[model samples]
Target chain A: MDIKSLKNYLYWLYCQFELITCSYLMEPWEKLLFYTFNITMLVMVLYTAYIFVPVHISTAFQFFLHLLGNQHENTVSVVK
Target chain B: MANPSAVCNGHLHHHHQKQNNLLKSGIYKKNGITKGMKKNGVSNGTLHKKTITEHFEQAPMYVAVLTFLGFGVGTIFGYLRDFMRAWGLEKRNVAAEREQQKDFVPLYQDFENFYTRNLYMRIRDNWNRPICSVPGPQFDLMERVTDDYNWTFRFTGRTIKNVINMGSYNYLGFAETDVNALKTVTIELQKYGTGICSTRQEMGSLDKHVELEKLVAKFLGVEDAMVFGMGFATNSMNIPALVGKGCLILSDELNHTSLVLGARLSGATIRIFKHNNMQSLEKLLRDAIIYGQPRSRRAWRKILILVEGIYSMEGSIVRLPEIVFLKKKYKAYLYLDEAHSIGAVGATGRGVVEYFGMSPDDVDVLMGTFTKSFGAAGGYIAGKKDLVDFLRTHSHSAVYATSMCPPVAEQIIRAMKCLMGLDGTTQGLQRVRQLGKNTRYFRRRLHEMGFIIYGNDDSPVVPLLLYMPGKIGAFARRMLEKNIGVVVVGFPATPITESRARFCVSAAHTREMLDTVLNALDELGDFLHLKYSRYSKSSHPELYEETRLELED
Candidate 1:
């Protein structure tokens, strides 16, 4: 056989192994849909985390600053 | 339950019809009638055919999910702990070894053994329990205590005594062969001392070795036989001597690692068939013949099928009848390893061939070990005289390793003599029959207890499923506490969810001893909640029946 045909044959042979009978290996359309759902879920998680984490971290930092820095300033200036 | 053979027969009927279609398609030339075609083209009549029943209980769907999830969560946590250790947030008391070895290129690669440090270490006490006595009906395990999380253990110098041995592979109770073969030991030891101090290929070939080989060949009903000092080496070394570059080896997926190594060393094109699945084997054989050797597209010099008579871990017998049929039809060589089944099964302790009433000539290569059943050390390769002659000159074990010791050979000779009734006693016959009785009774009782069991009822190697990895150690330690020793097998030797406690029922075990083990499992089953099989009707019929119906609902 030609190199291209042999490569195609080998790839077909590789796909014969049912890698994920538990949840995966399905009809092409169903597999495509399932993979779309998975990729979407991953993207949504990444987007939500990207939108939430830094703001939350900064807010928490502000709160901690009020607890430590404000108390030190009030004690030196107002209490004295 | 009414007729167990019906289940297996139904399976065979389905396969027969499916393959009949394939046969009609003209892929097969001769001997294609797989079900009942016997030697010399004799068609199987009703009296000539027998159905061998084998049952393997599948875990419930939820159990599989849980096992998969458990493995995943365990892996995540393990990697997280590794990250923490890397960040110096966690400290291990067992860093002593790594710290000392940090000098040169880190000779011992313990870091790569992630499973050991994380999962295996947690349950390390269940394995390698030092036994202080002969592994007969009962033995003593030296007690050990681990303070630093099984990293280092200090033996307490005290032994747990009189524990019922449910884990040893003394199938014919020939483990006491030393005691039984005492009469012959004097002459055996006197003539050829204890050790050979030489390899068999050169100076180590003693008179006893020659006699043992001849006797082995006679016993197996083969042309010739060669014995090896090590059982593992028998496969790992001899296989390469048989097949090489231009050859093809179709090995069972569950074949012993020795066979795998040997197949790799032989430089043959190796293909794996699904374990004991004839359809998968047929597909592979067809594909192999069609494809020929890869790249070159040249016909393989030879095609060999490697299978085990009884898989040690799985406790299942190979479907030998069908394999032989397939081998004959496809013109491939058959290699049968009867290491666990040789003296453990069959009517007269011949092996799976005798168990199935098939002739030994059907197999091209017959290999077996004396370690399990003969109460001796070493293994043998029995086949055509040509194979033996070739192996004698080429096999690395025969050429390099020390020969089988004199006393061990004597022990084996005595065991075989007794088994063949040449010793003028029915003791061997009795042991073989007793083993079957014990195996069946034990399996049935365990089945009735509603526990999930694996393998055929006739197999002496009984593996009771404990899905949760935690239960592997729990069942083992609890059984040890109850004075019954059992072996626990778990990941990564087996799949994560398929962890099981294996019990090897010996002919040495009396009815009462078996009863004691049953009682222990009965109590432990409830305590561990391991009785997950709703298929079986338990002793308490009404109670289990109600539960079964409720679950079905």
Candidate 2:
């Protein structure tokens, strides 16, 4: 639907592919190569998450502040 | 046109004309006018016309709309029915839960689990990938992918050439690229086309059939002979005709399955004698003659003793002289199946009787197959003229099955002629002698190697016993990797734990080629720890002596 959702869908597809291929890669050397491929995919996903983390944390903090303000107003009204 | 009554009259007139046209075309018919219409003092045609006009005027739009509604509802119903069917297929049927009860598998399902899933069968599948070349000294076999770590089999579909052939029943190597056999085959192919396309009883038999029968009878010194298309069926189909329910059949324990099956189909009481054990056979014969039959206490109409010239599995030669003595003593007929022994044994290659210096007449029914010795096809029942004639008329195999292909029969005839010294060459006799030499040389070498082998010393069929079921696959794999084709047998062909590889010696094999095989086997035996029977070398030296004595006789 959106760029972020599309990216998530692509990541999901890659994870499924990796899982299936991991089972198929049975030899020790093949597993070792697959392990390297898995680590690379993990690192790429981590880097993407790092780029979007600042915006995500700020938005989460603002939502928590608005909830606290509403709670305080409700408490004052009850006291009155 | 604007006046309502005038417009209505014009529409009525058009409808009346259309009705009249339909009546003239004979599309509509009326039986007889009703009494009420006749009594109305108006004619029947006028009354009928009035009734039709009245009916058409009433709700023509309603009828069309009703028809469309019916069609739409019917289509919707059809779609719903199809959707329900698909949905039912997606779910498991509760009614079939009875079949899912524990251990309630169908017979075929049990077979799949027991036989198809067996380890040896799996190994066999991997061992025998089809060969592209002739089944001779060297041929190509498709490689099987059984290695680990492959997600899927990436079939190379390429053939490996020049793999030493140690399988196939090409006893004298006649099936190989023999110039004489091939030339005969070419000529026969042109003369006979492919097959006769009819049963032997019909128009299938050609002059060549008569020629072959005569040659076989002459070669074996029998009065007459009859041939069947399939070697296996020759025994299974003909045996029943020879003996029936009132008869008794004493079969050797280790005879080929075809003989055992034939004896069973005869509906005779079957008694098994220990393989190549003359004493056991004599004891059985004595008891049968004395006791008559178990429950009936009546003497048997006839008693038939069945034995193979050479036991295919154990490679032991039948004690023909001793058996013949017992058959005569008991007044029982002897049926000797020489499917394996005919082509590979004796000085002249006439089979066991020739090897043992006995009369061919000693065997009442002399059954031998051309598949092994002639390296062609079909089998023959050779005996007295009356027996041959009787079988010709009554044998189900001859009557129902198509005769052997003319080319195959010709190949057999050519091979026979060569063996008989009629081809004006020493090549046939030389090949037979070479086969004897090769068989003895290979068996002796294997014995000297401390490898536990089965079979008589002179037998071309040398079975190297492994005794371990698990290692059969390993031995086969190792041999194939070394580019040698070998046949490995396990249960139920042999005992459960007595798995072994059967190596049939062909005359085409040179001394050097056999040594190459021995070298590979030695390495494999060492790697797999298969040299357990090293100490038990030549368990039956007396059996070897017996063969020598028979040869001397």
Candidate 3:
């Protein structure tokens, strides 16, 4: 993956991790908005990866993004 | 403007700005640098939903750990506080126990030392004795008699056989172990449990209380009777309950302590007459009527005359007919305490009124106790229904104390029944008659032997005069050596020089016992160097009185 892709993926992973961890400490409005934004960004990253496009995302960024996505799914199911 | 170096530098600057925005929002703002970030146009973390979730995640784990630590520390501190308190109490208890042990002394030695130093010296020196003294003259006399007579006064674990109880107030010997009476008591105990916990006004009173009162009233020939915890309490409760602030009490000087306490508590004006002196009583009565008037207007209410049916220490009977005559003449209420008379005097052992054949109505109030002849504890006052009704409401002692245990009341009832002839009238009368005969025989025999006896000729109490106060101890010691029990009463209970040994005769005494006691007395007279011839002369000095005539102008 390219540096630009790596940086964007890293930003997305950081947001998802922050949204899940911060949810316990945040008020309900902040927690809901952050969670929705992370979910939208995570779907966009996964769709870009699945389309076989020449994505510029780096290996490290992909690894972190995958870890955040799995954690987000687990947290959402627990809340439901 | 398309310079390659400039374009690259611009791209690097834009990328740095975006990364700085993300880092400022995530790291610096979340780490609480709101003031610095807000100045740089970065929004403060106004995310309410995120903050709430954060608080929930932190509360559970933090609260659990803090609460558990607090509880553990508190338990340890609480245990340490309790241990320190218990240790302090143990130290205090040990000190108290050691002090008590160090001070302990035999009661008899203490009593003797107290009496000799305090009582005997005061009497010998002609100083007035206090009302209650330990080693008082009276106790000295008792000790002297016990020593001289070789009497065994076994205080602990007393039984019928071990005791030759000359100090007992059981005048007629009715308190003797009667098989039939014991059976009655046992039957009553089986029927009723041991005690009733409430006062008479409450559920504590039982049918036995009513029955005992009824029997006592009938025996005394009065309208009714109200029971009390003791004979002393009867006077203490009834007197104050009956008379109030404006009333006057004319008391005989020799009336029992109960009467004195009762009168004092009543807040009444008390005038004491000479012992058994009706003239003095009449004078006091006349004076009260004349002087007990209010300065504002009319006279005060009539006075009350208080006397005992029998003077216990002197063993003298009250001149009841004269007292009744004076009561009627002055229109005063007469209150009689028959503590020592009932079950001992009168034809049927009905006490002073019966002994004198006077009507019960003549005496306004009559009180007696069960301890003497009834072989039980407690007392009763017999009077008109209204007076008893008033006392039931006002008597403080009655209202405050626990009610009498049922077994004691039952015993009194059975004893009263036995005395009044539920068993048989003939048997009861026979016992009383025998007691009268025994008293007469004992008194006559002692008088014939030249002993100066105190009291009326028919009285059961025969107080032998021992004249020399100093010899009281020696005389008592000799008497005790003979295994005959008698009490010596001297100063305080009696006048200093009037010290004497008081002998009580009971119906239980066999003829052999009387003979044995008389023989011992006769032997004691010689042993103590007492001259029998001087007894007649000293006891009857009136025979030597010379008549003188006075001239009037």
lDDT scores in order: 0.79, 0.71, 0.61
Better of 2 and 3 by DockQ: 2
TM-score list, all predictions: 0.76, 0.68, 0.60
For model 3, the superposed segments whose C-alpha errors exceed 4 Å read A1-80, B1-163, B293-298, B529-553
Give the better candidate number (2 or 3) by lDDT: 2
Model 1: clashing residue pairs?
none
Q: How much is B157 displaced in model 2, in angstroms? A: 1.7
| Candidate 1: residue B545 Cα off by (Å) | 22
Scored by TM against the true chain B, the candidates give 0.86, 0.77, 0.68
Cα lDDT of model 3 by residue, B11-116, tens digit:
2222223233333435534544334434544334442211110000112343234334433332333344335545773222111234346567533334344344
Q: Is the docking of candidate 2 incorrect, acceptable, medium or high quality?
A: incorrect
Quote the RMSD, in angstroms, for model 3. 48.7
Each candidate's DockQ score against the native complex?
Answer: 0.02, 0.02, 0.00
Per-residue alpha-carbon lDDT of candidate 1 for residues B135-183, written as tens digits (9 for 90 to 100): 8888988999987657678999999999999998899987762654677
What are the runs in model 1 whose C-alpha is more than 4 Å off? A1-80, B1-48, B89-112, B177-180, B536-553
TM-score of 2: 0.68
Error of 3 at B168 (Å): 1.4
Compose the digit string of candidate 2's lDDT tens values, residues B69-168.
Answer: 4333323333443355447733321123244674775344342234323233334444446778777766788755644322124457777778888887
Candidates ranked by TM-score: 1, 2, 3
